[model samples]
Target: MDDPLAWLDDTAQARQAAGLRRVLAPRDVVEPLVDLASNDYLGLARDARVIEGAVVATRTWGAGSTGSRLVTGTTRLHAELEEALAAFVGTAGALVFSSGYTANLGAVTALSGRGAVVVSDVAAHASLVDAARLSRARVVVARCSAPDEVDRHLAAAPETRRLVVTDGVDSVDGGLAPLAALHAVCRARGAVLLVDDAHGLGVRGPGGAGLVAEAGLAGEPDVVTTATLSKSLGSQGGVVLGSAAVIAHLVDAARAFIFDTGLAPGSVGAALTALGVLRDEPERVAALHRAAAAVAASARSAAPELGVADPTAAMVPVVLGEPDLAVAARDACAAAGLRAGCFRPPSVPEGTSRLRLTARADLSADDLALVDRVLGEVLPAVLGRTGVSAG
Candidate 1:
């Protein structure tokens, strides 16, 4: 008992030595900086309309959702959001959760069990991996799919009841999963394909329907999709979309849904409004893709050896090869009044760290130029490349 708490100090010291200690500093308001770190791809987070909707809902419904959804939490706002979300993503039904993480937890655990096997990509999001862990299913890590790797995994595990789980877009590298091919593999094996479209909703597919829709798998009986409203939708919450029977099963069986409080009324209202915005302004999705591609191209031109992948959506990761340098580059961008994300060690599976930049629809050509300038100046120093000059 006397020494039980001493290990905490030792662990903290170890993290500090490795430069991996994390801390929180809450911002009071927007700082005078160009932000590339945020996941607000549609730039609607602070939009007047979205904010107004939230305000109206708060006034009408009171602050919280009140209690668990099964009790007194369900409201008309929540119902409306679910209906709109299901229709938007081309699903027969949808169920909302407190966050995208919880949505993944619910979908994965509910759909599969000890008798099932979850074939997941090596690079799937942390939430999905955690869901697989909690599922009590045999999880097989498949090599990140090209167009054929998924089929290979399915073939190898032919006798098992399988569920193929993959990110619609790889979060760190911004590469897309081959959903159409993966869906075909699942179909051939009589398995279910679950695509987590957290980064793809309101950014990819027709009318911002998401990646599953883009691959023509949205209405397929063997496919399911999950997404975050906090990203391109500019709201707060998550949803699982699939066949009516699947959603009905989750409503009764998913522990995250049964135990967690319903999404706040304000978030439901904001999400509903954002969906309407997407319906009327489909061009915003195109703008986001264009911005991401432009950023990737600019970074490649500045550092020909950086190996910037052409983004399939709004995220772009500029590889830096080492962890300490990635953090240094991120700090330099912050110092230059441009904020970008740094990914290292556990956050990235490949052991190569990177600067994860998210392109927003509101970021202008001038903003992109500033990003290029900051990185060109900072990256060489961070990467320890002596003679390279800033562009």
Candidate 2:
């Protein structure tokens, strides 16, 4: 009784010492700051059409989903969203989930089991790793961002039913997976390829369909894709898209799909509207890519010593070697009225903490200029004593 909670105190102290003390600061929606951290790639979160759709759907269907989809949760709105999403992404069918993380978990665990082997990229999102852990699958972590490693892993485990899982776009580094090659490897190994296109949808591919489509792997018989509505759709849910039979299996087998609360009508409506908007304005995707490239270019020009991976989508990471420096750089940006995302250990496999800057279609050139100025000032201080120069 004297020191029952002593371990908690020590853990907190250790985290604090390493500059990893996380905090929750609720932000004011209308704060005067340049935002470069949000996942709203298409900037439809506040669009009148998107907001109005949510409002109408909420007024018509109520606030919450009220029950699981198997109960009273499968609204007509959800059906419409599923249909639209499937068609948009070039898949035979789609099933919406509460969140992207849950979608990944549901898809992976349902598709893989004890006798199965999941050849996952070393740098996949935490959700996929968690899904693999829960599946009791023989999880093999291949090389970071290398499809060849996936092939090798599959080759080494020829007897197991295998699934090659990866993020279409690396959330931290903004690098794209070699999805076409990965799919080829999967095909050669008779494995299934599951791509989590959370950061790819509404930012890449034809009319922002996704990276799987961009790589010409969409609708492939052995390929499955998962995406989040929260990112570019400006909504709050996730979807798994694949062949009709695969989706049907998920409906019957996935616990998350069967037991979890369905996506609310409002989110379903918003996502549907966002998809329409994306179709009507394909240029938005192009703008997002351009903005991301511009930001990456600026970072490279201003701080060449900083490892700024070339962005294939809206995500851009400015690599800071240490967690303490990353936090300091992020704070410096915040102080200068710029909001940026910070990524550290566990989230990044490289063990190099970074400032993750995400570009939105709504971010003007002026906003990017502010990002440049803030980083120019903060990066130097963060990289102290090295006296680094831009390449």
Top candidate by lDDT: 2
Q: Tell me each candidate's RMSD, in Å, in order.
A: 1.8, 1.6
Q: Please write out the lDDT profile of model 2 over residues 358-384, one tens digit for every residue.
A: 999988979888878887777777677
Tell me the TM-score of each prediction against the true structure.
0.95, 0.96
Candidate 1 deviant stretches above 4 angstroms: 144-148, 156-160, 385-391
Model 2: residues with Cα > 4 Å off, grouped in runs: 158-160, 307-309, 385-391
Q: How does each model score on lDDT? A: 0.86, 0.88
**Each prediction's number of clashing residue pairs:** 0, 0
lDDT value for model 2: 0.88
Weakest ten-residue segment in model 2 by summed lDDT:
382-391
Q: Clashing residue pairs in candidate 2, if any?
A: none
Model 1 residue 346 CA deviation in Å: 0.3
TM-score of 1: 0.95
